[model samples]
Target: MSDSGRRMRTVLHADMDAFFVSVELRRRPELAGQPVVVGGTGNRGVVAAASYEARRFGVHSALPSTVARRRCPHAVFLPGDHTLYSEVSRQVREIFERYTPLVEPLSLDEAFLDVTGARRLFGDGRAIAAQIRAAIADELDLGCSVGVAPNKFLAKLASVEAKPRAHRDRIDPGEGVTVIQPGSEQEFLDPLPVQRLWGVGPATLDKLQRLGVVTVADLRRLDLSVLSTSLGANQARHLAALAVGADDRDVEPDREAKSIGHEETYAQDKHSPAEIRRELIRLIDAVTQRMRKQGVGARTWTLKVRFAGFVTITRSVTTQNTVDESQEIIDLLTPVLAGIDPSPGVRLLGVSGSNLGTPVAQLTFDDVADERPDWHAATDALDEIRDKFGSDAIGRGSSIVGGRIRTIKRGGQQWGPDQPPSREISHEDDATR
Candidate 1:
C-alpha cells in the first residue's frame, strides 16, 4: 500500500501491564514472580492493581482488601507509589509524542494514538506500536501491550486481547502486540462473544443470550427494530453499528479535563444532612488544596450526593466570580444541598470545582486595592502553613468540630482504580454572561 493508503489502519492503543504493581515491583524486585497487590491497606480499602500471580488466586483490582487477603494470604501488598507511577506515565507519554501528537489518554495506564500522519516519518502503524513498546521496555523496564487497528474500538479490544487476564487466562503474550489490518475488523470480532462488545454488561449479556444472541456475528444478523425494543433505540443502533465494525471516533489530542472533584463511599450509610454537609466541607478542602497547588481555580462549585440506592446526582452553581475557598464553595452549593432530601440517607458525598481556569470577579477600585489583597494574603498565609505543618495544621472550625475528614491523595485517580457502581448525573449552569 502507498503511504496515503497505509493511513487506513493507523490507530494504536498502548496499555501498561499491571501498572501499580509493576511500578512497585521495580523497587521490590524480591516480590517478582510472586503474588503482589497495590491498593488501600485499610479494612475498607479496595484493590487498585494486582500482579499476574495475584490474579491467578482471584485477587483482582476492585476486590476488597479483606477478600484479597483471604484469597491469597501470602501475597505481598502495598498501598502503592503513585508519584513514581505518574512520573513513569509522563515519560511514556513523551515517547508516544515522539511518534504521534494525536494521543488520547484513557487513564494513567492506557492511551490511544492516531498515527496516520506519522507513517512516512516512522514506518507504519505496526512499526510505531513496536517502537513505542520498545521504548517503554528499554527506558522504564516496564511491560506493555499494544494494539494497531483502523479505529479506537478495535484497537482497545486488540489491546485487551493482547494482555493477561484474571484466573491465569492470557492471550498471545508474545511481544504483547496485536495489529489488525484495515478491512479485517469484522472477521476479528465476529467469533468473540457478544459480551465482549462495548455496553454489553452482565445484565445485557444475559438479555442478549436469552434472545439467542451469543456473538457479534449473531448480533449483526438482527434487525434494528428487534434490538431496539430491548436495548433502547440509541443503544440498539450504536451496538448494531459497532457489530459491523463501524466506528469513526477520532483520537482527541487535546481532551482538556473539565472538572476536578473528590468523593468518598462511607463505611455505613449516613442519614444526617448535617453530617453529609460536614463531609462536603472536608472534601472541599482537599479539592481546593489541589486547585491552589495546580494554580487553577474554578467558576463553579458542585456537590454530589449518592443516595443509599446508588443513585448519584450532582448539582453545580456558577458564581459571579471565581473561588478556591472552602467557605465560598459551601456557600455557593447551599441551594443544591438544601434541595437534596437526605431523609433517605446518603451513601456517598463529594465536592468539586469546575468551569476550569483561574477565578474571575468584577472588582471595583476600592475592593481591588483593599479587600482582594487581604483575602488573598490570608489564604496564601494558610497555604504556607499547610506546606510546613500539613493539611491538618489548618482547618475551618465547622469542619474540625463536625467529623474526621477522610484523607486521600491527588497524585492519581480520586477513587480506586476500579470503576464505581453509582450512576453519576451532572447538572451544570452557564457561567458566562
Candidate 2:
C-alpha cells in the first residue's frame, strides 16, 4: 500500500500530548519549560496529568499527589479546569469532523478517526493526520501526536509510540506522527511486550508470564489449543487474533456511555455519619448533573465505599422509575449509606448511575401531596448559573455551609507540597463507562 491513497482501511488515532498540563501551559506560557502537575495539590489528591518535565521525577496521572510532591518537590501543581478542557475538546472534535465524520472520541484528550473515505479528498492517511495535527496546533496552540495505521489497535499503539518519553536526565521528543503501512503490521508489533496487547490486564499478564510469553513473538509462538486451555477460549481467540494484528473493530462515532460516575479518595477517613451523608449528597448531585446533560436517567444507583485498609464494598438499588433528580437519588441512597458500617472509617466514596434510558415521570400518590420544589427546574437554573459565571458561582446550601462537601476547587493554585486543597476534587474513575 502506498501513502498516496487508502487501498486498505485507514485509521488515525490522535492523542493530545500531556493534555491537561499542555492546556495549562498554553494559558500560562511562563510554565512552559517547568515541571508542572495538573491536579489537586492536597494530601489525598490524585495527579490528573503531568508534564514531561514532571514525569522525569516519576510523577504521572492517577498517582497520589502526596507521592508526586515527595518525588518532584519543586513541581508546580495546579487544580484542573475541566470546563475549559471540555470546551477545547469540543473544538478539537470540530476540527476532526472537518476531515471526516467517522471520529470516535475516547476521551477529552484523544480520539480515533477512520479516514479511508476521506483519502480521495484529503490525500491519504498520513497527509490527513498531518493536516489535523497542524490545524490543532495552529488553532488551539496545543501539541498532539497522531498514528496512522490499517486498524484501530495498531493505530492506538502507534500513537503511544509516537508520544514523547521522559527519562531521568532528559526527555525524548518522539515522532509527532507515525504511519504503519500495510504488510508491516507484524514487523511493527513483533518486538513489543505482550502486555502492550489490548485487554491484557494484571491477571492476564500473570497468566502469560507463567507461560513464559513476554513478547508478542512469544504469544504468537503459543499454539491455539494451549492458549485456549490457559486463558478461557474466548479471550484466547481474542489475544491470538490481536497477536497477528487482525483487529477489525470499526471506529464508532459518538458512542453512547454505559454508565456515569464520580469518586473521591479522601486525605483523612470520615468517622462521622453526617460527613459521609454530606459527601454522598454531593456525589449524587454531580452524577445526576452529568446524566441530565446527556439526556439520560438511571434506574440503578451504586454506592461504592472504600475502607481505610482499601477494603471496598458496593451497595446498589434499582428503582422502578428512572431518576435524574439529585434529591430522589439522595433519598434512595441515604438508607443504604446508613446501613453500611462506618466504624472502620471510610477513605473513599463513589456514586455511579447505570441502566440508563430516557427519564419517565411516574406520578406517585405521595408526590401529589408532597409540596416540594421542582428539582428539575432548580437544577436547570443551577446549570445555567454554572454555564454563565462558572461551576462555583452557585451551590446547594448544605454544600456551601461548612465547605467540607467541596472536593478540590477547580483552577485553584498550589503554592507548595503541603498546602491543603481549597475546594472539592471530582475524580471520575471511568468517564467513558
Candidate 3:
C-alpha cells in the first residue's frame, strides 16, 4: 500500500526476443548461432526481424532490405512466415492466461499481464516472470524478456532493458527479467536517455536537447514553462509526469480493435489508372475478407493515396448499413479514387474499414430483391472454400488478373516506417490476425 492507501499493482510485460527470426530458427536449428534476417528480399522489402548475430552488423527491423544486404552480406535471409508466427503467438498467450486473466496483448510477440491478483497463487512478480520465461524456453524453445513494474509505462521500459544487446564482438545475454519495486520508479527512470520515453522521436529529442535536457533526470528538473516553450504544453506535461514516474494507467485486457487496414508501397511509382485500380480492388478485397473472418462489418470505408512526392490525401464514405462485401466496398471507393489525380505517380495506396460492428442482415422487399443479391451468403460460401483450400485457391475475378494478385503478408511490422501508413488520415493495419 502507498501513502495514499491505494493497493499497489503488479504489471508484467513479456516481450519475445527477435520474435520473427526466433520462430524461423526453431525449426532450422542449424542456423542457431548464425546471423539471420527475416523479411522480404525485394528492393522495396523491409526487415521484420533480425537475429542478434545479424544486428551486430547493423541489420535491424524496418531497415530497407537492400541496405540490410549491404550491411550483412553473409546473413541468411528468410521471407517471414506470418501464419506460423500467429499460431506460435497464440500458444504464448495461452501461457500468459495460466497466470492471470488480466492480460493485454500489445502485439503478436508482446503482452502486459496484471498479476497483482495472482501474487498469492504464483509467488511475487519476479518469481512469476522467471517461471514464464522458463516455461517458454522449455515448451517453445524461444527467448522472452520480462519486466515487472508498478505501472504499464515503466514495465514496458524494463522489458526493453532486460533484452539482450548485440555488440560488435559478442551478444550480451540480458538479465532475462527485471523488476522495479514500488516507490523506485523515479530512481529507475532517471539515468535512462530521454529518447527512451514514449513519444520522444527525433524532432522531440532535438527540441529537448536545445533545452539542455539529455536524460530523464534533466527533464524532470527543468521548469514546465520552459519545457512547454520547446515542446507543446500537453507534451511537456506528459513527459514531465513520466520523468517523475507518475503514470496511473491500468492494465486493460481484451481491448477491442478500432479498425482494420492494409497498404503497399510500390517498388516503382505507379502512374497508370488501370494499375492503380487493380491495386485498390485488391486492397478492398483483403480488408473485407478480414472483416468477414472477424465477424465484423464496417459502416465507413476509407481510401488512402500517397503520391510520388509523399503528398498524401484520403477519401472516406459512410453508409447506414454495415458492409462486409468486397465488391460493395470497391464500388463505393472506386469513385473516391477516381477523384484523386495520379499523374505525378502514386507511391502507395491503402484501404481500411472503420466504425465496425457485428454485421447485421437487413430485410429486403420483394420489389428490391432483384436489385440486391444475398451477398452475405455468397461470401460465406466463398469463405468456406478458401478456408478448406487456401486464400489464393479462389478469388474475385476483378481482383485477380492474368495470374495471381500480389498481396503483402499481414504481420506485426509494416514495410516503411514502423507507424501506420497514414496516421493522420486512415486507420492502423489490423495486425492482430
Candidate 4:
C-alpha cells in the first residue's frame, strides 16, 4: 500500500512475559529455569503468575496454590512483591513515554503505543519499538515482547504471538517487534482460537463453542446478523470486526482506570468470621495504600467472594464519606459476609474501591496549644518513613495487635509478622467453638 493509503499507522502492544515471576527472576537470577509461582504463600493463598516451567504442569494465575502444588510439586512458590514490581513497571513506562507520549498502559506489564506520529520524532515504528524493548531490558533488566500492527487488535494479537519462551538463550533482537501490515491481519488471526479474542472470556467461549465456533475463522464465517442476534448488537459488531482484523480503536494515551482492587484466594477455604475480618483489614490497608499512592480516593467499597465450587458473588455499598479506615471497611463488610450462606467454604475474598475522587487531605488539631501541626507535613513525614523503612515502619496499633493480618505486595506475594492465616465463616444459627 502507498504511504498515504496506509497512513503509516502503527500500533504497538508491549507486554512483559510472566511479569511478576519475571521481576523476581531479575532480582534473583538463580530462579531462572525453575518453576516459580508468585502469589499468596499462605494456607489460603492463590497463584498469581506461573512461570513457563510451571505452566507445563497446567499451573496458572488465580489457581489456588494448594492445587498448583499438586500440579507442579517442584514449583518454587514466592510471595509477590508489589512494591518491587510497581517500581519496575514504572521504569518500563518511563521508557515508553520517552519514545512517545501516546502510551497507554493496560496494566503493570502491558500497554499500547501509537507510533504513527512518533516516526517523525524518533524513527519508524519498528525502530521505536526496538528502542523501547531495549530500554526495558537494559534499564530494568526485564525482558519484554512487543507487537506492531496497523491497529490495536492486530497489535495485541501480535504481542500474544511474541510472548517469550523459555528456550531462548538470548533475548531475540527485534524479533518481538512483528509487524502485520494492512490487509494481512485477517489471515494472521484466522487460525487462532476464539478465546484469543480480547473480549472472549470463559463464559463467552463456552457459548460460542456450543455453536461450533471454535476458532476465529469459524466466528468470521458466521453472518454478522446472526452474531448480532446471539451476542447483542455492540459486542457482535465488535467481535465481527475483530475476526476480520479490522480494528478502528486508536491508541489511547490517557486510559483512566475504572477501579482499583486487591484479592486473595486461600490455600484452604476459610470458615471463621473473625479470620475473615482480619483478612479484610489487611486488604483495606493494601488498597488504601495503593489509593494514597495514586492520589485518588474512592466512595464505594465492593466485597467479592468465591465459594468452594467457584461460585462468585460481589456486594458493594456506597459510603456517606470517603474514608480509608480499616475499621470502616470491616463494619461495611461484616454484614455482607453474614448474609452469605457459608456452605462450601470461602475460597477467595477481595476488596475494591470505586467512584474515585481527588485524594482528600487529612486535618489534625493541637488542643493544648493554639498551634497545629500541618496535616500535609505530617502525612508527608509518615509517607517518607514508610517508603524508606517499609509499610511496617508505622501502622495503627490495632493493626499491630492483629497479628494474623499480612501485607500483600503488588506482585501477589504475602508477607507479615507471622505466617499468613485463613479465616472461617459459620452459617449456623448457634455455634460455640
Question: Model 1 RMSD to the real structure?
Answer: 6.9
Where does candidate 3 stray beyond 4 Å? 1-7, 361-372, 401-409, 416-433
What digit string (tens of lDDT, one per residue) describes model 1 on residues 81-131?
676878889998999999888999988899999999899999988788888
Global fold similarity of model 3 (TM-score) = 0.90
Please report the TM-score between candidate 4 and the true structure. 0.77
Candidate 2 yields a Cα-based lDDT of 0.85
Can you tell me which runs of candidate 4 are displaced by over 4 Å? 1-7, 42-44, 165-174, 202-214, 266-272, 307-311, 324-347, 359-390, 401-433
Q: Give the better candidate number (2 or 4) by lDDT.
A: 2
- Determine which window of 10 residues in candidate 4 has minimal summed lDDT: 424-433
Comparing candidate 2 with candidate 4, which one achieves the higher TM-score?
2
lDDT of 3: 0.84
Candidate 2: 10-residue stretch with minimal lDDT: 408-417
lDDT of 3 by residue, 145-174 (tens): 999988888899999989999999999999
Regarding lDDT, does 1 or 3 come out ahead?
Answer: 3
Between candidates 1 and 2, the one scoring higher on TM-score is 2
Clashes of 2: 9
**Candidate topping TM-score:** 3
TM-score for every candidate vs. truth? 0.81, 0.88, 0.90, 0.77
The predictions' CA RMSDs to the true structure, in order, are 6.9, 5.5, 6.0, 6.3
- Report every candidate's CA lDDT: 0.78, 0.85, 0.84, 0.75
Question: For residues 128-194, could you state the per-residue lDDT of candidate 2 as single tens digits?
Answer: 9899989999999998999999989999999998899999999999998999999999899899999
**Candidate 3 residue-wise lDDT at 316:** 94
